[model samples]
Target chain A: MTPETVTLILDIAITISLVVGAVFTLVGSFGLLKLDDAMKRLHAPTKASTLGVGALLLASILGAFARDEPSLQEALIMAFLFVTAPISAQFICKVNLHRRSCMTPPEPSSDSTWATLDTADAGDAPAQHLTPEKG
Target chain B: MSFVDYAIYGAFGAVSLAQLLAMVRLILGPHTADRILALDTMTVNAIGLIVMLGISQGTQIYFEAALIVAMLGFVSTVAYCRFVLRGDIIE
Candidate 1:
């Protein structure tokens, strides 16, 4: 293919990627606003918004190449986001669980309480030992 | 303008709208978890905006900024959750 054809193809790819990313992002945030429950709200941004950002980053990478200045910096952001999105989501879930903001999980057959709700034993809570004595 | 420019502009508009929606959620969220989730979503949207800006400007300087924002956002989200869960972030 000619240079012009390759550039055209890359541009088209970038444009398509940008459009997809934007639409997914808007949908994700809209879901966040419209969902009636906290857990349901969590479902939207973590997955859909992450995918949206990934698509945008993909477009950035393609755009770099289109400009004949290819770089991989966008990949760093993408990888960090992919790795951390679920983790943050999990933390948010834990917060929801701890606060009892959503439906509680079914009881475990063996454990008496869910982990998030379990209180630390006095013997096991080192924080108790770390308190400064009052004068 | 070409279709590509239109697409770029449209992406900007859509992402900005998304950011606005996330902010509305932040303000209207009924629970603490919902507020934290909104903050997290906002950070992600901010990163998107930064990336889009980089794309439009054809610059790489914003990469570090986006990465830092992502890192701090995750850390802040986790810290907020931990604080709410255990009443302490470090414990």
Candidate 2:
């Protein structure tokens, strides 16, 4: 193909990627807002938003190549995001689980043991009104 | 305007609006975990916006910004989660 044709193809690819990435991010964020459960919210940002940003990063890489600069940094950024986004999501998920237990009615730890990590006193427990488990 | 130009602007607007929605969730979350989730989503959206901006500007610098944001956002999220999980950052 001619050089002009190649340029056109790259431009088109970049444009598509950009639009798709944006839509994915928006949908993911909307899920975060609308979803009622914490676990459910995890699905949106971890899967869709990550894919969205990944697409944009891919576009940036393509744009760089089209300009003859051919940057590898955007690729590195993509890799970093891929590695960290899940780990971050996992961490936040764990936090949510623990925080929920702390501030609400205690649940059995599956070992039949109630989770009483730091009962700092009556005042410390904000959700004391929540009935404690009777296991 | 060209198709590419339109895409750039549309991506910017969409991601920005998404970021706003995440902010609303952060403020209104009934549970601590919900707030944390909102914060994490915000960081992800911010990274997407930065990368989109980089593409639109045809620059390399914003790529660096996106990488930095990713690294720091992960660390902060992990640290905050750790605090909630263990009630302490160290030991």
Output the number of the TM-score-best candidate: 1
Model 2: how far residue A8 lies from native, Å: 0.7
What is candidate 1's lDDT per residue for A12-124, written digit by digit as tens? 99999999999999999999999898889999999999999999999989988988898988999999999999999999998777666787689899879877667666454
Model-by-model DockQ, in order: 0.53, 0.58
On residues B12-63, what C-alpha lDDT tens digit does candidate 2 reach at each position?
A: 9999999999999899876776777788788888988887777777788887
lDDT score, candidate 1, position B23:
93
lDDT of 1 by residue, B1-91 (tens): 6677888899999999999999998888688888899999989989989998988988888888999999999999999887776667885
Report, for every candidate in turn, its global Cα lDDT versus the true structure.
Answer: 0.87, 0.79
Model 1, runs deviating above 4 Å:
A120-135
Model 2 / residue A125 / CA error / Å: 15
Candidate 2 per-residue lDDT, tens place, A34-53, comes to 88766777788788888898
Query: Which candidate tops lDDT?
Result: 1
Indicate the residue-level lDDT of B2 in model 2: 71
